[model samples]
Target chain A: MLLALDVMGGDNAPAETCRGALMACDRFPDLEVALVGTGSRVAPLIAEASSSVAKRLHVVNAEEVITMDELPSVAIRNKRKSSLRIAMEMVRSGEAQGCISAGNTGAIVAGGVLVVGRIPGIDRPGLGVPLPAIDRLRMLIDVGATVRSKPLNLVQFALMGGLYMRHVLNVADPKVALLANGEEEIKGDDVIAQARDVLRKGPFTFIGYVEGKDIPVGPADVVVCDGFTGNILLKVMEGLGEAVYALLREEMGQRILPKVGMVFMLPMLKELWTRFDYEQYGGTPLLGVRGAVIKAHGRSKAPAIASALGVARDFVLKRGVELISREITQGGM
Target chain B: MLLALDVMGGDNAPAETCRGALMACDRFPDLEVALVGTGSRVAPLIAEASSSVAKRLHVVNAEEVITMDELPSVAIRNKRKSSLRIAMEMVRSGEAQGCISAGNTGAIVAGGVLVVGRIPGIDRPGLGVPLPAIDRLRMLIDVGATVRSKPLNLVQFALMGGLYMRHVLNVADPKVALLANGEEEIKGDDVIAQARDVLRKGPFTFIGYVEGKDIPVGPADVVVCDGFTGNILLKVMEGLGEAVYALLREEMGQRILPKVGMVFMLPMLKELWTRFDYEQYGGTPLLGVRGAVIKAHGRSKAPAIASALGVARDFVLKRGVELISREITQGGM
Candidate 1:
């Protein structure tokens, strides 16, 4: 199966993207990647790949590029020939089974909705990211896909997220929940209450409202919320993780005994970090869209990009979009 | 100055609360603490203190106790003679300069508003907790005080938080910011945007918008948000810290090398924990109330309760409530 990769996306653009494509091709013999970018930047990188890997890599040269700072809708409308838009178009036209882009998140979400379109019966698409919890991976939905979500949209997120967790991630009898400030029945605002009301009768076991603390504790397999809350929570967790690691390193370096202890603890610390790192988790899937669309992190390196490609390949193979579409249609929102 | 302590509150009550009160009395030679609880439960604990401490510690008999699981408003109204309510009453009647409670947060907010009352010109009271950031402490407000806040209420939170940080925390010019999904001007929902517009024309230097990640980085001295968002953010940070510490301990115990390294790293790690620990920072102040009402953590032990008492003392000494009242009335909220 052919997958499209936006080579002009992310901080480590064409070089890391190219390296990732080759790595993915090497890992999956059945997979082929179409690198989307300007010919000048994309052609030379493909040449560096071995003959066997190079054959599976196809370069789709698009002259325009979208920077990280541009407005999503405006940039998508103006830069139709941009690598991000072209890669999205590949998924739209069925040329690629799935598309992965590490470009601006806003632009990618806009492009995914406007270009790839929404799934039938889905009001708004939700972005789902797998958070590495203590016991299991929990899928948090609408992590900045649609900033302002209605109750119906949140309900759709639960349905779509629940399906993704069950089908793609292979979780048996996935427990879905709404993320709120409190766990009580009357915890969140009107939107959350309404969503919880609908989800109670809908497909799967609705675990009611789970607070932010419950995310790491792995209370629910699929946690749904509006894009605004999810985005803030995601970033806060990331920032805290970075701060903790940095503080530990600084503290260990300043003290004599701890500095000596750091030598023996380095291997264990590295392993623990790898277990918690978002890069190892690959991309966040933009669910409820017409086609499979994966958004790799903007700071993703070669390894992360390769991991995202693997995710895209799995998402396509698992028929995530098809499962979600069926579930939403049958669930009667 | 006299301060009232809710002896029947928190996971470690009576014993911890009495110990903390004695410790506070010993530290502040001029300070007296009224231990409010059942005479049977509190009298013995206070008698265990030294002669000087016992003389300074007064026993106020309270027949009832507010459990953590009870509804805030319902419990506050019904449990009139409860330890929590009696402590709040001491502040209300001017019997004590301030009150410290490590009880149910909802009950505290309800009781503070019901008994101690709101300051004039203040629509809602906000709970401000000092987050230990890398460079300095950033105070986050409206953390589960009034869960659903209007635009005007958010604006009020900013003003109160700013004044508290400037006057009580001693920041020369406090930078106030609204916590939102994004840093962009048009980021959050209508309430946040409206609040930002009003803050722009207000007295303090409005920093516009800061995301959740900015809390740990200390971009703004005071971060204001609706209680729902603030509460989740605070709890999530606490939960993450606990999870990290637990994981590290478990990992260290499993590995022989890391186990030996942990022995050497124990002191440094303990010091680091103390620095980041919320217990060390003391209680969260219920701002915009008529009197100083400090809410300690529900799981607070003796040391945390002692630290909370210190915070209560400082809040009363700095005239936190009067300053907030003057600012709100003059600032035209």
Candidate 2:
């Protein structure tokens, strides 16, 4: 499968992105990548690769680059020759099976909708992030793809999220839940309540409402909500993880016994971190779009970018976009 | 200070509730408590207290008990003699300076509004929870008190929450932040955007928008949002904490060296738990009510109950309700 990678968007930019692309090529034998970036920067990295690896990796020159702070609409409109836009265009024109970018989330989401376009029956494309739950991965949809979502939008998110979990994550009859403050039928606001009504009778396996804690606890396979709530939930978890690490380090400093103990605890701590590693999962997929589009985390380095490329490859190979569109059309909820 | 304790509600019930009242009376020299519950169950627990504690603790018979599963509106209207309602009535009648309950949150919120009543000029009462921040305590308001809130309600939450931080928590000119999906001025939904406009012009130290991570990371003293979002954020944190604990325990079991290390690391881990302990802070105050009403966690034990009682005592002593009313009337944003 062929994939387009934006090599000059994220914090670590060309170097990490190029290195990640090479690493992904080594991992996926059949995978071919088009490194979309400036010729001067990307050519040397492509030239340095081993003969077999170099054969799979191609440099597609694009002079301009989209900065992180640029407005999504303005950047997409003005920077036509930008690597992000060029990579997206490759997917739109069917030059590549999928596209991966560690760029501005807003720009990626905008490009997913404006350039690649949404699926036929989908109202708004939702971004689905796979969070590592207790036993398996749980998909949280609309994590900042579309805010100010209506009841219909939430229903769409539920359907799309459920499909992603089932097809991409290989969960049979994925249990879908609407994210709310409480698990009761009468718990959430008007929007959530209305969505719950439709979901109870909708196509997917609706397991009812779930609270925030359910994300980490792994009650449901697909947790659906509006972009605003989902985004907040995602960020809070990230922030809490950082805070816990800081607090633990501070506590470790106060006692000499624990400091000595820390030497033996290093392996266990490494295993714990690996169990909850976001880098290993790669990128969050912008679901409901016509083409396979994966938005990697902005701060992602080589390992994370490579993992994201793997995700994009899996998405394309699994035919996620087609399945979601067909399901939404047939379900007709 | 005279306070009413609802001993009939919560998981631990009369035993923990009565035990907590006695503990609070001992801690606060000027404090007196009226234990509200069934005489049969509550009387025995109170009798076990020391002579001085017994002298200060009074039994107020409340024959009915509100179950956690009951509808808020139905429970408040029908179970008028319920311990939750009786405690609220005590505040309403000026018989107690404030009220504390480790009961159904919906019932507590309903009772605070229906029985204790909303403060004059207050659109809706919000639940303000004191979270342990990096440096000091940060108050998160509207955890579940008022859902389907308007922009006006958020503005009111800011004012009341700010007053709460300044008076009860004792932070001078407390910085207030509106919780949203992003920190950008143009980030949140219509209601938040409108609230942002009012907050920038209205009284208080409006610190623009804050994402979910700010709760643990400590950027603002008072974080205001609709009850729906706030409740989810709060529950997510609780869920995440539990998940982390479980994950770490699992990781520890996998290695023998780490198991030995865990013995010495217990103290550091204990300190970390204490630092993030919600029970030590006691109950969440129901702000914008006519009188002080603190809602303890439903699963609270004796120590948590005692902490909540301490919070209620502080709220009454600090004249939180009166100050909030006065500020809302004068500010009139």
Candidate 3:
């Protein structure tokens, strides 16, 4: 029931992380949070929160803060007292069932692998990120877990992703597909070609190839690819989303009629923005690990951190990580 | 200069192709086109045009048409008299300086290799596509030209992409960067890691690594990567653009004030759409080829085809293709 949180991670650390923990505590009655950060930094935020929210939260002091650009290997070796390390340690020692960090991605990936460790039979871990599409959130797996991937790894990714979607998200019979350049079977490189054959034999609903456009269109609930491709897709979608918003703002000039028109469209625009909101999706889970380790966005606010905690709770409750391990071991290709 | 046109290719076929050719001629006085397709199918479209516009257009007798889903190797071997083949043949025989097609991409790549051939020392060709960022166009080289690429191929891509940007797009000393998962020097796969080393020694201005987010932000004028990565980026961007538009439309409903606001924003929205318009980008040029061969979008209308013709003309006039051959051979990385 207890979750360790890296409060000193992300752009607006301690403050947002503490507030988000408070929000998650308020949202979930059974949840307890171990807020790992500097005591002095988190005390004021903890004081400001309501008594009911504060009762469910506890502070685990760790003074050192790892900057956004710090090397993951260096942090893993040198910064033993860092919030990310401390939070991860909590999960390792069984003090917390899961942990979340809104910090450096590289550090989180490294910390998850080195500290939390992979499940017994899993070859490699994959980050299953929920990318918000027009109608629903499409899970793009292996979004920079490990750059190098074998065909067998992609098949494992499909299994892990399907388990998460089916158990956590409650999507029954998740339709999985390989993320290829073209929809046709013969339209990919050697890795994809080999993965296609392996995926067909897996337990998930293996649909044919889905192109890049299909990611935003929601052709399949779970789209599996190598870490490199998945990372690029995830980041490009992020950048394009920003570019689109920038374009709309630039084009929405301060004309009299248009200015008045904006008032009417503000609610609708808000609604549209919320549809693709990352805050609701929370952090990404590095599935195939022994315990839940969520990588919240680098610039995560109170809402995003709260959503991530909710996801972490769901991950543990639904036994998603355990399910992946069992599935991969039993569904031997 | 004379150019070969594939009137039977694309969704709209001879009508859009003929109109696009006429528009290109009207825009550029010195241009002449040998429209290659069935004479029976193209006659009415040509006759329907004004006398002045039709004067520069000549229909070459190519009755065969290649379907979109046909296998590339099959299209190459079996459909010899297809419009795609006839246009490539025009480039090979010196009948025309260049050719343009809105047909099967795989087929175009195959014919370009089989008929037009590689430019002597060039090992493989790359498709240099102009993707419009908010600020300007960034040339994403090797957009599905060759899926599997070596370190040397990436070096060639940088040189070829740099030449196209400098000469054709008029961006002198374009900053070149390898597309990686992260911006850090060591943060990439083995192929990218080795390519990074090769790029530093190459002729162009080699700026280290650029992430997918950097593509829309316009950090580097030319972003080089293998075709698989490049194709995913290109297609994903296209799909995301569509998704955003769909989101806006769906959200715009529900309120009466938002409905009236749409009228005021329509012009600005139209202007914004034109900025990222694929038609404006024309088509991607198969850059390491012997002659200019631009691959227009398959669903291209008159405007896109017209833009592609303009691109083909620029490719020839600027000697982009020949320059790539010379640069790659002489650079000898």
Candidate 4:
């Protein structure tokens, strides 16, 4: 499969993106990676890879890079040769099966929608990220994508999240639920109440309304909500996880006794901490688009970028975009 | 000051309630404690407390106790002589300075609204609970009270939450913020966007739209949002906190080495854990009510009920209701 990688993406980019490409080439020798960015800037990092792995990598020379501060529309419009835009174009023009980026999210999203476009029946595309729950991780969608949404938008999110879990995570017939204040159908606002009705009547094992606490309990497979609530929940969870780890570290470092305890429990703590870490999960996928567009965090390192590339490859191999489009069009009307 | 205490409230119920009342009586000698419940079932617990430091405790005759499973309205309607109703009536008739219950939250809210009524000029009343943040606790209001709210309701929540911080927590001109998905003015839905405009022009020390991560930093004194988002955020925080604590406890209990270390740091760990304990802060107050009505946790113990009563006393003494009513009427127009 031919996958386009935006080398001028993320905080650690060109280096991290280059390393990830090389790593992907090593793991999947049959896979072809087209590194999209200024070839000179990306060459040093790409050269660090083994000759055999480097042989599988191709350079698509794009002169411009989208900065984090630039407005998404302006960046996408002005920098036609930007790595993100170029990579997106590769997928759109059938030069590559999928595209992956760890750059400014707004810019990547804009590029994906403008270049790849949305599926036929989908109203708005959504960003889905895996959250660490008790026993397993749950998928939370519309995380900062589609700022304003209707009941139909939420319905599409549930369908997409369900399909993603089945194809990517290999969870069959995932339990889909609407995120609300209460678990009752009668609860929540007009928007949520209407969404619940529509979702309940639709396909994919509808589980009705799931409360916020249920998100971490692994009770439901696909937890759906508007972008506003979903994004806030995602960020809050991220902040809380970081804060707890920091607090624990500071407290453990204070005294010799606690330090000893930390040393003894370091392995177990690390394993448990891994559950809340998002880096291990790679990046969020912008679902409901006609083509695969994986969005990694802007500060992602080599491992994260490589993971994102792997995710994009999986989507391409499994024909995820086609299946999601079919599901939406079939289930929606 | 006479305070009515529901002896048969919370998961621990009569035992914890009776003990909390006795503790309050001992702490505040002039404060009169009226234990409201069926004298037959409550006599044993009250007698037990009387043997302690609560010889002067008063027991009001009440036959029925609302169960968690019962519907709020049905429980209120059927159990006319229930402990919850009697306790609320005590405050409404001025026989008691305040009412405290660690019972069914919906029933408590229903009883508060039905009995005490909304304070003048208040559009809708809300519940404010202090959440454990990174450094300090922040107050989150409208947690499941009014799920479908307007722009004015959000503005009112800001006013109520601000007054709560100023009077209850003693923070002057507490920075108030409208919780949204982003910091931008154009970020949220129409209701929130309109609320932002209203708050900017109102009496609050209005800090613009705050993201979810901002809650933990305690950047704003008051964090306001609609009940749906507020409730979801509150529950998510609770679940996350519990998960972290459980993980820490498991790690601490792993082996003999960590167990030995745990012994040395037990005291310090206890102090740190207590700092984030919600029970220490007691119940959530139903703000914008004519009289103070505190809703304690269903699993509240003697100490939690006592703390809640103390909160109620402070609310009454500070004349928070009158001040909030005045602010709403003046600022709203």
On DockQ, the candidate that comes out on top is 2
Report the Cα RMSD per candidate: 1.5, 1.4, 1.5, 2.3
Checking candidate 2 for backbone clashes, the offending pairs are none
lDDT of 3 by residue, A1-333 (tens): 999999998998888999999999999999999999999888888897777888888999997877878888788768999988999989988889999999888888888888888887788889999888888877999999878789878888888999899999999889999888788877888888898888887688899798888988966999998888888878888887788777677666645655666777777888777888899997899988889999999889999999999999999999887788778678764
- Give candidate 4's whole-model lDDT: 0.83
lDDT (C-alpha, whole model) for all candidates:
0.87, 0.87, 0.86, 0.83
Chain A TM value for model 4 = 0.96
Model 3, B203-255: lDDT tens per residue? Answer: 77899999988889857999998888888888888887788777777666656
- Evaluated on chain B only, candidate 1 has a TM-score of 0.97
Superposed model 1: Cα runs more than 4 Å off: none
Give the proportion of true interface contacts each model preserves, from 0 to 1.
0.58, 0.77, 0.68, 0.56
Prediction-by-prediction clash tally: 0, 0, 0, 1
Residue A184 lDDT, candidate 1, scale 0-100? 78
Q: What is the TM-score of chain A alone in each candidate?
A: 0.97, 0.96, 0.96, 0.96
DockQ of candidate 3 against the true complex: 0.71
Instruction: Give the per-residue lDDT digits (tens) of candidate 2, residues B1-333.
Output: 789999987899989988999888989889999999998888888887888888999889988999989998789989989988988998899998899998899999999889999988888999989987655788888899997689999999999888888887788889999988888766888899998999998578889999988878866999998898899889888888888778778877677999888888887778767767888997899988888799998888999999999998888888887798788778864
Using TM-score as the measure, name the better of candidate 1 and candidate 4: 1
Candidate 4 residue lDDT tens string, B207-253: 88888888887478788988888889888888776766776687667
lDDT of 2: 0.87
